[model samples]
Every structure is written in structure tokens, then in C-alpha cells.
Target: MNTTPLVQGYEVVIGFETHAQLCTRSKIFSRASTAFGAAPNTQACAVDLALPGTLPVMNHQAVVCAIRLGLALGARIAPVSVFARKNYFYPDLPKGYQISQFELPVVQGGVVEFFLGNEKKSVRLVRAHLEEDAGKSLHEDFFGQSGIDLNRAGTPLLEIVTEPDMRSSEEAVAYARELHKIVTWIGICDGNMQEGSFRCDANVSVRQPGQALGTRREIKNLNSFKFMQQAIDYEIRWQIAQIEDGHPIRQATVLFDPDSGETRAMRTKEDAADYRYFPDPDLPPLYISDQMVQEQRALMVELPRSMAARFVAQYGLPEYDAATLTQSQAMAAYFEAVAGGCGQPKLASNWIMGEFSRRLNADGIGVAQAPVAPAQLAALIARICDATISNNAARQVFDALWADPAGEVDAIIDAKGLRQMNDSSALEQIIDAVLAANADHVAQLRAGKDKAFHALVGQVMKASKGQANPQQARDLLRVKLQ
Candidate 1:
């Protein structure tokens, strides 16, 4: 009997559909408040609940936001579009249908480029459209009873759909994170996953090289990065194992069990045809003017990629350092503030990335909320550059400044007595004492023992209570020993 061998490490293809709730005050189609954390059904109105005799009205702010995002992604905006009712049955969806764009999406054909390690990867966006979010279902105690929360119902959502351009879970995650940054930086979405403001769904499949795509599984409602990675990995393995056992992979929606690190079938996947999409009779088609698109485009700030490149070219920083410093808008702004005034770019980068980041992490503070002011930090850097104090002494001053933002840097330096003893006479006495204390090492040094010289430097530092300039002490020791 002949048996087929199991395939190991088959390439996994991943695409993401991210839903970001727009930060708007009112619902997409109604006067209902779109605030989160309201009591059950408190924010719902006649239009949101889809009651009889209620008509859906489009929110102008929601449209503007969607167009802004589309322009930022370099997507083409549709001059006209229509809203279709997506037929679905779910407990959270108060209405039996969801109002979303089907064939006539608001924006189409864009690509987002981000770096994964050193290689640049691009995720092609198929479309980004406006939609109304559904209500929330709360399953507490779970003895077959659940409660529904309608506060989130009718919230405005921008659903971003991506092509299957990613080949691994890590690439998918990196793309998602970059997308999150863009939305947040543009002030479109809060990008808060825990609060359900930003949510992701991953479609995963495996195929041999140069073959048609296989049956894909949709992992739904992943709220965190770790779950996004784990869900895709487990789904890929499960699909591969089924294929190895001569079972065909099925098209379905699945739920991820984070505790068990596995995915279980939810239901059969439905295509657009199954949704019975059609233009809504109650709402009119949207018509956006070219002037509006141009306005939104003009409002876009320097994006992450362009800003990172400028940091490298303008500031003369390495690519890696610039990328790390510009990971967020706040960090980039902080770096710029410190790097201003013709300051040393490399030194500023090192301080911000090293001691500044260390202090922020240790104090449990964010860069935006850091207690240290930019001017104060810049002054400290200036002090180090001018040799007002040793690097070690400057660190002590930094701590003092961190403790009291209003404290003077020079006063702190003087109070801490951290000035380096650079005077030859003052350092000569400490050097003499070190030479007398380590006579054996001194003899070995005269006998051509180069290693003993380091011991003398250590002794000099110790005798001077770590205040002696190491370079000057070493130079004087070498001259005296000769």
C-alpha cells in the first residue's frame, strides 16, 4: 500500500477586514447618541431600532470621515455610491439587516506599504466603505441566558477590506498595526481594541505555489494582536491537518478559543449573493463633489512613512533609529523638540531611545504624558555636549529633573556634587594614593603588564569617589608611571 506524505510548513495566506468605529457624536442615520457604555438600549431611537414609519438619514460627518480616510490611503473616491441592506440574522443585530455598501463602496483600489523587519511589504486594499454597527450581546453567567446592549447600535463604521497579499500571520499583524496607527494619527478612530472601537477579522487559507486559492476560513472578532496571530496560526494548522487526512477544507466562519488556542466552526461562510444585497429604497444614493475630496486630501498631515523617511534624510539618523523613534506621532514630536536648534542628532536619538525611554517605562508614563519637558531635556543634552558634567553626572541631573520638572539643571548638578575633577592638581593626589595602594600592580605595570593599568584607573576612580575624569586620570597615570 502506498501512502501520501503530510505537507509541513505550507505557506499560509492571510487577509484582514478591519472595522473602525468613527468618532462621531451621533449615529449614522439617526439622532441617537453613539456614545459607548450606555445602559442597555438607552441610546437607541426609532430609526436605530428600525421601527415602522422611521426613515434612515445619512450623517454628513460620517461621510466626510470616510472620504478623509479614503484619501489618506490613496484610494479613489466614488463620485456617487449607494447603500445596500446586508441581510443577516444575529442576536446582536437588532434589525434583521445591516446597512452597508455592497457593490458601490465609497472608496476602492488603494495600497498600504509597511515594513516587516527589513523588507517592505504592501497590503492591497480592495475597498473601504461606510456602514452602521450593530448592537452588543452580553453573555453573562451563560446558563443559557444573555443580555443585549444597544448603545453601540447604529454607530458609524469604516470597514477596510484588504486583498490576500500577506503570506504569514506576522505580516498580517504588522499591516493591521500600521493601519491602526494611520487611523489614530488622523483622529478618525480611537483604535481602542478593548473597547471595541477597533476590531479585526482574519481570512486564512493555504495553497501550493501557482495554484488557485483554497477554501478559506474566517476568524471573527479578534480584539487583540495576540489573538489575531494565534487564531490564524491555529486555523492554518487545522486546515492542513484536514487536507492531510484526505478531508476537504470547508468554507466557514470560526471562533477562536484563546484559552485553548484553537478555532471551532461557527457557521458556513456566506458570499455577497447570499446577503441579497440591493440599493436601499428608503435612502438616496450618495453624491460627493470633487471639491470635498480635494479638501480632505489637503487636510492630511505628513503620514508615518514620509515622516520616517524625512527623519533619516533630514536628521541624518539611521533608518532603524528613525523608524523606532517615529513609531508614534507623540514620540516623533518629542524627538523633534529635542533635536531642534542644530543639536547633535545621533546624541539626541540615543538619549531619547535609551535613558529617556527607560525612565518613561520605569515610571509607567507614556511619551505624550512624560513629566520631563523637551526644553529641559534639550538643556541637559547641551550640558553634556559642553562638558559641564560627565555623562554619569548628567544622568544624575536627569533623575533630579524627572523628579522635579521645575528644578534647575545647574542647581541639581551643584547640589549633587557630581562635577568631574578635571583639575590636574586635584586628580594628581588621588592618582598618587591609588599608585601607593596598588604598588604590586604598579610594579607589574612598569614590567610591561598592560592589564595592570586598568586596575590603577579603577583605584583612582574609587579614591576620588567616582568623580575623577576617567580619560584624564588614565592619561596622567600613563605619564607618571613612565
Candidate 2:
């Protein structure tokens, strides 16, 4: 087992239950539109409303979504999976029962690999089952009464469950991000957390060393990554405090209050028996052939891990660089363009991961919205590699390109007078002048004082107005001193 992260002498164990809304045109069972932002109750069809004489029909596209996710995660797709009706009562659930895969889920036994900073980590998935989403309850707007929004009703969902493998909140969030990237990259889901397209339920608990597993409380519907970390951290601390006191941690469902940064129990958590799961008599068992799996596999784009491995092997990138670049398909493609254009894969990796990322974060924009095109960055990098400009000068060129993305790098370099002085004789003239003017510093250098050499180089650069290539100046100064 991996080393468990401890909080106040207690080991924290975290697992995740992520619901990915399948990208389809209609509801899972009904033929109603699944588009978002529709008026409440406008999108719900008679079947979704659980009207009498309604027989549920399975959505084939939803099954395809499940198979794609399975292949992406290297999981097994069962030949046949059954749908069960989970008996539950809620204002939003117009059917009074939810159709879900319980006894036999479609996708089974997968691992989601990611990194927490530079440490590679992976979480084993128990299963990912197909299900339909319940409606939404409007508690914020109505006056003292809750309203139902059935627009989300019957939307296809794949509920992915993970084992208790994450030892910290950071690992859990990283795993979630990787899963999100895979789903969005493959076009299975939009991955819009704000729109409720993808959400996580974190099961957090703490136990003493060498003791049995502790009771876990499920934090439900964490919509934001920031809030997910805060809620888990708070829950871990709370559980430790309760154990330190005389109180035992109870199993319950909780909610995170971002305003106060705390978790409060909403209700007692229920086990499988509480739901009274039974095979749905209305729907037959779902069957998948070998041909269907192969078709879905062929349709998938190059998966993130495979792309990352290719970057490491083909581009000579560090594992970290490959992983960072392959965070999204767009990012990886942007990097490949820059690398191919510059023919300097390492330099391309450095700029994209460093200055480019910094600028994007500062502007609150994504990689797609970057003003500096890959070709422009590649040109800048090529200039640096060819000794036409120093790293600092290349940054100046980057700034110019950012301001006017249409500006050519060579034009900007000439316009700003930022090109390095690479001519050896002209540089030799500046070196001679600096040597003649700074005899005292030169004497210190011959006496083996390394600082004097740098001082003379600074003088040469100053005399040339910062255009003199510092390395060439150093080379010329060494020869002159000899």
C-alpha cells in the first residue's frame, strides 16, 4: 500500500464517486431533449414524468459512452449488465425510483492515473455504471416552497466509483481532473461543472494506525475543485477532532458550505439494502458484442496517456513535461506545433510550460484563448537557439507578439532592436574597448577573481547597449586576456 497521509495523527482515506453526464441529444429513457438552460419542466416528457403505461427504452448512445470510457480506462465491459430500480423518495425524482446498474455494472475494474505535482499516482476504479439523472430542486428562488426543474430528468449519466486509494485531498482532485480530461477529450461529455455536467462525491474518513477502517461520510455534489479540497480537508480534521473527543464518527451524507468552509451532515447515509434495488422489469438486460466494443474503440481519439508516452519517446521530454503538455488535447497539439516548428523540443516545452502558462493564468484564459500562436512562439524559440537573440530578448519578442499576435517575430525583433550582436569582429571591438577601459577589473581576472570577468562582460554589454551577445563577449575577452 502507498504511504497514507496523516492529519493530526490520523490516516485519511478518500474515495470518489463521479457522475459524468453523457453527451447525447435526448434523455436516457425518454425521447426528450437533453439540452441545457431550458425552462424548468419544459424538457420533461411523459415517460420522464413517470406517467402510467410508460415503458422505459434504453439509449444506445449512452451505452456507447460507457464503452468509450471503459476502453479509455482499460476496464472490462461486461457482455450483459442489468438495470435495477433504486427505490427512493425525493421532490426532484418524479419517478419515486431511480433506474441504475447495481448487481452488474457495465464497466468494471479500471485505474485512473495522474500526478500530484511530480509524484505519479493512480486510483483504482471499482466500477462505472450507467444510470439516469434525477430532476433538480429549486430551493433558492421559490418563496418558502421548493419547485422542481425536470429539465435534467432522465439525462444519461455514468456513475464512476473509486476505491479508497487517495490519501490526501490533492490526490483526489488530481484524479478527478484526469478523469475529466479523458471524458472531454473523447467527446463523451462537456465536463462543465457549473452546468452540472460532471460532479464528484468524496467519501472521506480517518483512522488510527493499524486499526480497522473508520466510518466514512460522503460529501455530496462537489461542483468545484477548490471547494472539493476545502471540504475534504475540513472533513478530515473534523473526524480527527471527534475521535479525539469521546465522539465516534457516524456514517452520514454531508454538504459543504463554501461560505463557512465546513461540512455538515445532511442525512444518514444509506447502504444498498436501504434502496431495495431490484432488476427493472420494464427494461431488458443490456448486451454488448465484441464488434460494438471494437467500433467504439476505433472511434476514440488518441488517449491522454498514450499521447504523453509518445511525447516522452518521440520528443525526448521529461515525464513531467509530457504529462503537463498532455493535460488536454489542445495543449498537447499546441506543444507539438511549437516543437515541430522550432525543431527544439526541449525549448518548446520550457516556454509553453513556463512563460506561456504564466501569461494564460494571469489573463484568466485557457490555452485556446492564447494570443501568441504556436508558430510565433516557435519562431521566438528558434531565434534564441540560433544565437540571434538572448533569452531576455526573446521574452521581449514574446511580449510584442502577445500585444499584436499578427506581428511577425523577425519584424518585431528588428523593430525593437533586440537582436543579439553575433558578429565576432564587432564583438571583438567592444571587448577590446571594455578591456582597455577596465584594466583594474581585467587584472583581477588574470589574478583568478571570477567576479572581475563578469564585471568586464557587463561593461562590454553596457558599451554595446545590451545588444552584445554575453557568451561571445566572454569568449573574446578570454582570448584577449591570454
Candidate 3:
């Protein structure tokens, strides 16, 4: 609910409609293969093409996907929901309409909670209805006319719609990412934006504070988060420019062109009336017994939020850290194993989120594919905890281990001569010699210039060649200065 204006004096209000393709083996109403990259129309069944003597039968797995989503979002699952034909004409739609839930949907009234930076954000759900996908019109392969790919036709999709709760483009992106994680975590959808497994439609508008909501234009089919933010920001500026110029904002659907970094009007935005939605005469009501809901719930994996909460309670991590670590199951598992092995959750968290993730992003890989194993990382952290190595030395060890993942932590440290000098007697001699040589530094410290103490410590570090434990050196140096 951060209503602060991102730019200009208008408060930007945005809502999202995301269609997450379900992880079903078959289409929503047809037995067509729900696979990607098939030859155009090869995977389409007779029902998918709306051929003669064909009648739509609901895919039971699609209903299960809807149920799983409802449970994950804490939404209400309707025991009885009706499917309707949404009349719309498109070259890709063979039936000239889409079968979707209208008056009643399977899932209702849920909230998606996430963090925009450290601030918590929650978007209220209007409804998440079960629907069938349309085919794709290919214009690249054909010159004069567009070709249709019915392979994607009748594919199962869960259209998750949100209330107008987001106030900024950043918040909208955060919400979309959180929704993506939830769907993928629950194993309901693959959550692939590039392949169109997950697609987002952003409804963006702006208004003066305490004024009636302004006319909103829908930005359709945003696949990239970076591009989504760019589009929303541009749209906000464009709409404000229109209003300030004394022009009315027309409601329309727009597409973001990544090449131009701009949004162009695709068509006038269609309202519910334009669709002419009605009950499908061919299909019966969708009934989900309470038992069905419980069954899906039983099979559902431990959700990201639940695991994050556990991280906070069990490992004494901050809410932010817990949420970040639990962004994926593999990262969470890696963290737990390292924390359990080293008995240092905070350090483990820092290494994983900081260095580990940096490397992962740099190498374009994931935690599961990371070269460093959990045991190896845990052993590295243990060295730091036991004063066997300094943080700098540990980082060096990590680098060596990254190069050769099978390399042991202690072996690398010993081989590279990265072990810290922790012996108090040896450090005391070095401290005494530095103190004697830098009597001017002592005089400066006596005069209350705190930096002179660090100069003295630097002399000791130089004398010890960075082998001295810095913290222990500071402690011993403090006593000698007193």
C-alpha cells in the first residue's frame, strides 16, 4: 500500500493479470499434448481444432492445478463453478471463442504477499479462473498471410487477476516475481516467461491524490521484468503528458516494443461486455469436492513463505534474509545444509546470498548447478568460525574451491598458506615490536586521534604478512595501548 508517487504528482495505480500455463500433460479440454516446440498443429487434437462432432471435456488435471493454486494462495475453492464461452474472434482461436470461468471461478479472494525492497507488499486477488489457451499466429514464416499454430490451442492456463493494489512499477514487478515463485514452488506451473508458460498483462493508470481513478490502459503480454518496468514507467509518463496537455486518456490495449523501448496502441481495450460471455452449453458445471482440495494440499510441497518463516524462527535469520534464501527450493536447501553443518546461519546466509549468488549470476547458472557443494561451503564457514582462517583467507579458499570444487577447504587453505596466525604469544611479540618501532603512533593515540591505532594495527598486519587474525590483533593491540 505504498501510495507515494513514483514520479510527477499523480499516484500511479497498477494491477496485473498473469496467465500461468499449468504443468499438465494434456490440454484443458482436449487430449492434445501440452508440449512446447511441436510442429504447428501437430499436437492439436480434434477437440482442440473444434472439428466436427467434437465436444469439450474439462481436463481433470487442470482443475487440480487450479485447486493447488487456491490452496497456495489461501483462496476459497468453489465446489461448483460453471464454465462459459467467451465469444471473441481471432485467427488463432479456432472455435472463435474461449471457454473460461465468468460468473464463478474456482479460486476466489486470496492475497499475494511479497517485499518491494524491505517494505512488505500484498496484492488482493479478484479471482483466478481456469481457462483454455488460443493458438499462436505466426507471421514470420509467411509473407502475405499469418500462419496459425494450434499446438498451443486448448492448453490449460490459470488466469490470476489482481485488484488495483500496486502503486509503482517496481511493486508490480515484485508482485509478478513473487507470484512466479509461488506457482513454480507449488509445482503447478513451469513459470517460464520466455516460452509463454507465464505471461503478464499490466493495467496501468495514474491520478491526482484523492481524485477519482483515471482511465487505465492495459499493457499486454509483458514477458521480461526489466521490460515491464520500462513499459510501465513510459506509460505513466505518456498518460500524464496526455492529461497535462488537456487530452482524455483512452482505454486501450498496448504492446511494449523492446526494440524501441516504447508502448504502442494495439487496440481499444475490450471490456467484459465486448466478450459476450455465456455458459457453455456443451460442458457441465465444474465440481470440486472438499476431498479433492485436501488431496492437492497433501501433495503440495512446503511453500516458499512457510520455509522462509521456518528459516527465521529456526535459524535466527532476518525476515529479508529468510525470504531471499527461500526464493528457490535449491537455494533454501543449500542454505540449510551449510547452516546445519557450520552452525552459523548468518554467515552461511551472507556467503550464499552475497558471494554465491554473485557468482551464480556471473556464470549464468543456479545454486543447484553451482560448483561449490554445500559441504565444502559449510567447511569454509567452519574455518572462519574456529579462527582457522580470516575472512579474506576464506574468500581466497572459496576461489580455489570454485576453480576446483572437489578441493577440500582445509587442504586449500593449507596448500595456499591462507591460514590465520592465531597464536597469542606469537602475535604479542609482533605487537610489542610494532609498538616499540611506532612510538609516534602511540603519542598520536594518546592525543586521542583514533586513526593512529589503525596505523599501528596496519604495521602489525604488514609485519605478520596478513596471517594475523585481524580481530585478535585489534583486541591485543587495544590492551597494549591501554
TM-score-sorted candidate list, best first: 3, 2, 1
Which lDDT tens digits does candidate 3 get at residues 210-321? Answer: 8999899999999989999999999999999999999999999999999998999999999999999999999999989999888888898889889989999999999999
TM-score of 1: 0.91
RMSD of each: 3.9, 1.6, 1.6
lDDT by residue (12-33, candidate 1, tens digit) is: 7788899999988999999899
Candidate 3: which stretches are off by over 4 Å?
1-3, 141-145, 436-440
| Candidate 2 backbone overlaps, count | 0
lDDT of 3 at 407: 97
Poorest stretch of ten by lDDT in candidate 2: 138-147
Off by over 4 Å in 1: 1-7, 439-453, 474-482
Which residue pairs collide, candidate 3?
252-269
| Clashing residue pairs for model 2 | none
Model 2, runs deviating above 4 Å: 443-449
- Clashes in model 1: which pairs? none
